[model samples]
Structure formats: structure tokens, C-alpha cells
Target: MKSRRAILAELFLTAASLMALFPLAWMVSVSLMPPHDAVGFPPPLWPSHPTLANYRELFAHQNMGRYVLNSLIVASLATVLSLAFNVAAGYAFAKLRFAGRDRIFRGLLAALIIPGQLSMLPLFFLMKELGLLNSYGGVVVPFMASLFGIFLVRQYALGLPDEMLQAARVDGASEVQIFLKIVLPNLRPIMVTLGVFTFLSAWNDFLWPLIVLSHDQLYTLPLAVASLSREHVQDSAMVMAGAVVTTAPVLVLFLALQRHYVRGLLAGSVKG
Candidate 1:
């Protein structure tokens, strides 16, 4: 049942996948290698003497566990807050009637084109003024409500049956109760998509956290990995191990939830 073209396409895709994955695979392989073995010309693909020494060095000497915990705390808080704010705002934009709603949403959508970097200075100053600087709240607050998140949720929520919402309203359900009881359950796919997006963004964030967190105790995994690279410049294997540790959790989370993420994107794209 397969044509030559189909076979060729499959082969091309397989090759592309392997090519994309090769570097990550090599990173893991190098992480397992002994120090300096990875820096050799024509680096070996497999470790001759695999060991956990680099990981041990990272956790034991570098205090990497604290960084991991910090990242977890920041990312979890950001994801939860992003869901809370973006979901409500998005649903309101989609289904609720309010004065100036369209104009406000249009202004937000227009803002999507502006570079996010431009806002950093003002945001930093705002954080400083609020006394949130140099704290976890500083890292989490900026990402708690994002325009893209609002747009994604709004687009997906547009597809929800208006009749169901109206019926809930007629039954004398308060807006909060209706949203909690009716809307949230229907918005599961998009919620997962948004949550995963927020979590990954917060987890891997480097620059904002770097600027905001002053204490070594507050360093996140990306910052920790960067610092490790600086301290262990010659120890490529150790650096690779640090990279692996920084990358692995989010990679696992994405792989686990990719189906839902893809479905949400697809549904949102067409629903509006």
C-alpha cells in the first residue's frame, strides 16, 4: 500500500528526527564519560568508563539541589498563577459582555508584536518599587499573566457552547460558580497546554531570574548550570552533566503531555 514517495518521506523524517536528537543523545553520553574524555578530537560516542562522579560533584560540591528546588518553586508558582489569571481573563474576553472589552483585547493583541525585552526595564523598576525585587515573587510575577496565554485560552474558549453557559446563568449560577463548575472542565486541553507552556518557560528562564535573584541560595537550575560551566570550564563532562540535569525534567514533562499540548493547539487554531 506504500508508494515510493511515501517511503522516501518516511526515511527523510526519520533521518531528520535522528539528526535533531543526536546532540542531546551526545550530551547524555558525554555526561556519563570521564572528565576530559569528551573534549578529545573526534569525540567518542560512548563512555568507556561511565560514572556518576560528575553528578555527585554537582550535587555534593555545587549545592545544585537548592537551585533545583528554587526552580521548582518558581515554575510551579508561575504556572498556577498563569492559569488562574490568564484563564479567567481569556474566558471573559471570549464569552462575557463588558464595556471596552474588545478595545482592550485588541490593544493586548497589538502588543504581541512588540519585543518583550523592551518591557524588562520598566518591569524591573516596577518590581523594585513594589519591594518585590530579589525575591521569588519578582521572578514569578512578570509571567503570571501573558498576552499569548490570554489569546490561546480565548481562542480555545471561543469554541465552548454558548448555550451551556447561558443555561448555567439561567439556573442562577453566579459567574464564579459557573466558571468553576462549568467552564474549567471544558477547558482542560487548553489549560494543560497553557500550564505546560508556563512551567517550561519559567523552568528554563535564565535572564530574568539572573537579574532578579542576588543570593546564591535563590539561583535557579539554568543559572546554576551556567555558573557550573564557568567554574568547570575544562571539565566538559561535568558541564554536560549539569546541562542534562537542567534539561531533563522539562523534557520529560513535555514528552508526557505532548499529546494534550498538540490537541489544544490544533483545537484553538480552528475553533476561532
Candidate 2:
């Protein structure tokens, strides 16, 4: 009976996994199919005669490489800055003692309830005032780990041993030293988790970048994909190829860090 249940669970999980991956697999299949075939009445699952012409056209005519580079640059910058800023701020909130600290942190948590979309108009206006509209800085300036990220870090940081921090303080270690030497080392797993979110969010972002980056040269991959879709409305294969290009990096990144991400979340879940 136990063996029967185990087999049933394995089958269920395998089926679910295949179900989830089917779209990506189909996208790849469609991207490789002859250009017009992907949109035909039958819509074949696998290409009858797989060809590289779509990808060739994408690179040669569309200048998609530039969009890929833009995404990498913007996402990398956002990840690093978000990790640095959020980690420090989160650690301060978790450990440091100052007046109204809890109150301020609670207010930040409360702010999460408000929808982010509601702020876009004001944010765009503020960008216009700062002379950051239609620029890389505009994208990077607003791209950072969000409120939920801060909460994640704070919850994880609270798990750090207070006695270890006290001992470091006794040894004349400055706050910066303690943060660098003690907090960061203990915080590695959660940092990887947060980095994944920050990087993926920036890479996948479209609406803000659309509002800011009016110039062709500044467009990121998602924006480029949307533009390509509009221009090549009939070319489903090309659009699918562009999607694979945009999605590949994030998938690779998440797969690489998934172990750490799981550990971090599992450990942080019980924090008070």
C-alpha cells in the first residue's frame, strides 16, 4: 500500500512538472518551425522542418542583441544596488535600536497593501522633473528591491544571534564592520533569494520602461519583444523566438539559485 501511494505521488508530480514545462517546450518548437507554419490552422507541436531562419532574421534585421545587452545591464545594476541597499536597511531594522524603529518598519509593511500601479503616474511625473525620462538612469533609479524584499531580509536577519553581535561590539568592531563581517555572512542564503527576485523583476519590467524609454536604442528585451510582435504580427515563429531570448536568462538564473532560494524561504517562514 505504501509503495502504491509513493508511485501515485511520483506520477502526479511528474505530470504536473510536464504540464508546467509544456508551454516553454511548445514555444521552442514553434520558434523553430518554418515561419508561416507556426500560425497555420493545424499549428504543429513540433516543427516539420526545423530551421534557424527565424533566429537569423531576428539577429540580422531586428538588432535584438542590443536589447539583450540592455536587459543584462539594467538587471545587473538593479540586482546589485537592490541587494546592497535592502540588506543594510533590513539589517538595521532587525537589529539596531532607535526611537520609533518598530513603528517605522510597521508603516513600511503597511505600505505594501497599496497597489504599486497606482503610483506610476506620479512616478512618471517625478521622473520628468528629475530630467530622467527616456534614459537608463530613469530605469535604474526606480529599480530596487521592494517592500516585500525588505520584509524578507528583516525576518531572516532577526535570526542572527544577538550574543555574537554583542561580542563583536565589545571587541571595538564598528557598526559597518559588524554588518560586513557578521551579518552578511549569515545572510548569504536570503541574499541569493532576494537577488533572484530583484534581477528577474527588473528584467521582466515593461510598463515603466515603456513610459520612460521612448528612444529605440534604449529599449530592453521585453519592450523589444513587444515592438517586434507588433511589427511582425504574422510571424508567430519570430515572436516565439524573441520570447525565448527574453526568458532564457531569467530561467537560467533561477535554476542556478533555486536551492539557496528554497532554503532561505523555508528558514525565514517561521520568523516572528
Candidate 3:
């Protein structure tokens, strides 16, 4: 039988979980309500008559389908690029011997303390100079690599057996061959975690896309949802539906891959 303290702890955790989930549940509930049913002085906890009209209207009139496609393209590209760049850099940092390698990594760690917002001006100017503004490339460029990604992969890669890599080299396997054949397979867990992270970040990103993408057709789901809010300010139900649409994909992806993500994160943390 469970101890009283354990039961209390379980009850407390359940309550906390409910509290955390309440807002998301309410958002879903309000999305199914009638057009203006959620705008009252006392907001509703449940829809009186559930309906799919809000979702239909969003896809029909707001060009939400295009926005979802745009988001998918950007997020998928960003995930691929992030894996390509970060995994290589991280493995190099963890296993390779090179002059200034430690110094460079230390500098990167130091730079993490600096706020990302401060770099927007320079990044914007650079994007403009490259003529990538208002393009898909502009949206995907910033996510090609990230400091946290490198850090996480580096930590996980540090746990890889060095003897195997040395043996492969002794057998005349080139560095590229070893990395492709050996390192990549071993790095799957962290790769999944990083891919999920990059996809979600790129999918939900609004500020950078907002700044770089000026045309309405180039808008991502978050940006489209924000625009929809302005255009339908009084249609709370429709806006909630847009929010649900914007959130659903990433939420599902995370839920599906949560085990791998948690395992990778925990392994990286302990190894680091």
C-alpha cells in the first residue's frame, strides 16, 4: 500500500498538472464555441453547442492552409539544416583535436550570455545585404545552426567511445567515412531531440519572420494567426480556432517524440 505522504504527493502533482493543462483545454473549448459566445463578461468553461464552423471559416477565408504549408516548409528545412550543421560542429567539438578548438567553444559559451534580441539589427542588415528578405530562405537561415544545439549535441557526443573511432581510422577509414558510418548512428537520440526542437522553434517563430517577410503570402501560421486576430478582433471563437490550428501540429509532434526527447536531454545533461 502507498504511504500517506506518497498519496499526498500524487494528489499535489495531479492538481499541478490540471492547473497547467487548464489554459490549453479552455483554448480548445472556446474554439468550438459559437462565433461570439466566448466574448461575454464571464467567459465560458465549455461550449454550449460545439461546432467546426470556426475551423472551416479559417481555412476558407483566411488563407490558413497556405500559412500552414509555409510553416511546414520552413520548419522542415530548418530541422534538416540544423541537423546537418549542428551535429557536425558538435561532434568536432567533442572528439576532434584542433588548434583553438577549446578557445572557440569557450567563446561560444560566453556569447550565450548575450541576449539574442541584440543581434537582430545586425542580422537584419546582413539578410538585406544578401537579398534574402521576403523569401523562404530568409525565414530558414537563422535556424541553420544554434548555440544550444551545438552544446546539447556536444554533450551527448562526448559519451561516444573513442576507441571505436580510433580503430576505424587505423583500418584506413577516412574521417568522413567514420563520422558518416559510426558517429551518426550513435547520435540518433540527440539528433531526434534537436530536430524536434528546431522544428518547433521555426514553426512557432513570429518576430524574425515578421521582420524579414513583408508579403502576406509569405506569412507562417503564427503570423497568419496574429493577422487573423486583427482582422477578426471580435470573433474570439475564430481566433481561438486559429490558435488551436497554430499549436496542434507541434504539440502532436512533441507528444509523439517526447520519450526520445526526454532521454536525449537527460543523457546530455548527465554527460555534460
Candidate 4:
């Protein structure tokens, strides 16, 4: 009876998992279906006949390729720049002695409690004043560093051996050299984890890019996909294709680095 119950439970869990993933599966199935086949009176769970016509249409006429490139460049740049800024500030907060460091960090932590949206109106105006509006810099500048990123790095760095830093100091190594040579190598795992987090966040960001980038030419994938959805409401297959293109890279990145990502989450939660 116990064995039978266990088997039943497993089946139930598997069904639940499938249910959760059904939308994604359906999206892919429909995207591969013939353009008109997806929107029948009763939607088909599986494609009757699969075709690449929707994908071809997305790239050929919709200029989705440019949007993909925009997302890639913006996401990559944001990740790299955020990593540099946060890692440096985090390491300083963790290892270096300075006046008011703890107080400043506490202030930042408090600031994190406020929603990012609260700053958007002011931030947009600031970008406009700097002539960064409608440019990549406008989207990338505000996100170059983050309070959460700094906090995460500081937590990880706090656990690192201080003796290694002292050894580097004793050797007359400058702060920058010690950070580059001694600290950065040891930070590889956290860096990978942080980079993934930053990349995903930036890539998936919709509202800021939508507000800042008025030019269709500068639209990232999410923005472009949204625009396509509005313009091509009848083209369910094509819109799903766009969503697949927009979501696939980040999904792949997450699946590949999920272990590190989970570890970082745990470390941050426990340490903070």
C-alpha cells in the first residue's frame, strides 16, 4: 500500500510539473505551427504541420535580429559594468577599513527597501538632461551598479581569508594589485553567479527600456516583442516565436548556471 501511495504521489507531482510548464510548451508548439493553424476555434495542443515560416517572417520583415542584437549588447554591457562597480564597492566594504563605511552601507541597505520604480520619474529626467535619453547609455547608466549587487558581493567577500590580503599588503602590493591578483581569482564563482543575475535582470527589463528608448531602432527584445504583440495581435504564431527568441537565451543561461545562482541566493540570504 505504501509503495502504491508513493507511486501515486510521484505521478501527481509529475502532472503538476507538466501543468506548470504547459504554457511554455504550448508557446513553442504554436510558434512552430502554420501561421493560421494556431488560432483555430479550439487551439491545437500540437502542431498539425510544423513550419519555420513564422520565424522567417520575424527576422525578414520585423527586424527582430536588430532587437536581439540590442538586447545582447545592452545586457552584456550592464552585466560587465555592474560587476566591476559592485565587486569593487563590495570588497571595500568587506575588507578595507574606512570611516563611515558601515553607516554608508546601512544607508544603502535601507534604500533597497524602496522600490526602483520610485526613482524612475526623476531618473528619466536626469537622463534627459545628460542627453542620454533614447540612447543605450540611458538604459545602461542607471543600472551600472546596484545596492543588492553590492550587498551580495560584500557577504561573499566577508567570508574570504583576510590573511591573504595582509600577505599581499606585506609584499608592498598596492590595493588595486592585491584586489586584481589575490581577491579577484578567489571571487570567480560569485562573479559568475552575479554576472548571471545581472544579465538576466537587464535582459528581461521592459519598463525602463520602453520609457527611455522612444526610437524603434533602439528597442530591445522585450520592447520589440511587446510592439510586435500590439501590431500583430492576429499573428499568434509569430508573436510566440518572438517571445521564444526573447526568452530562450536567458533560460539557457539560467539552466546552465543554476547551481551557482542558487548558491549565491542562499549565501546572500543567510549572510544578510
**Candidate 2 ranges beyond 4 A from true positions:** 1-12, 36-42, 263-272
Model 3: how far residue 233 lies from native, Å: 1.9
Q: Residue by residue across 152-269, what tens digits does model 4's lDDT show?
A: 8988899889988998899999999999988999888889988988888899998999889999999999999999999888788899999999988988998999998888778667
lDDT of 2 by residue, 87-149 (tens): 988888999998999999988877877887788899899999999888777897765657767
TM per prediction: 0.92, 0.90, 0.92, 0.95
Which residue pairs in model 1 clash with each other? none
**What is each predicted model's overall lDDT from 0 to 1?**
0.89, 0.86, 0.90, 0.89
lDDT tens readout by residue for model 1, 191-258? 99999888998999988988888788898999888988887777888888889999999999989999
Among all windows of 10 consecutive residues in model 3, the one with the lowest summed lDDT is 263-272
Q: How close is candidate 4 to the true structure, as a TM-score?
A: 0.95
Q: Is candidate 1 or 4 superior in lDDT? A: 4
lDDT value, residue 155 of candidate 2: 83
Residue-wise C-alpha lDDT for candidate 3, range 34-120, written one tens digit per residue: 776777733588989999999999899888899899999999999999999999999999999999999999999877777767888
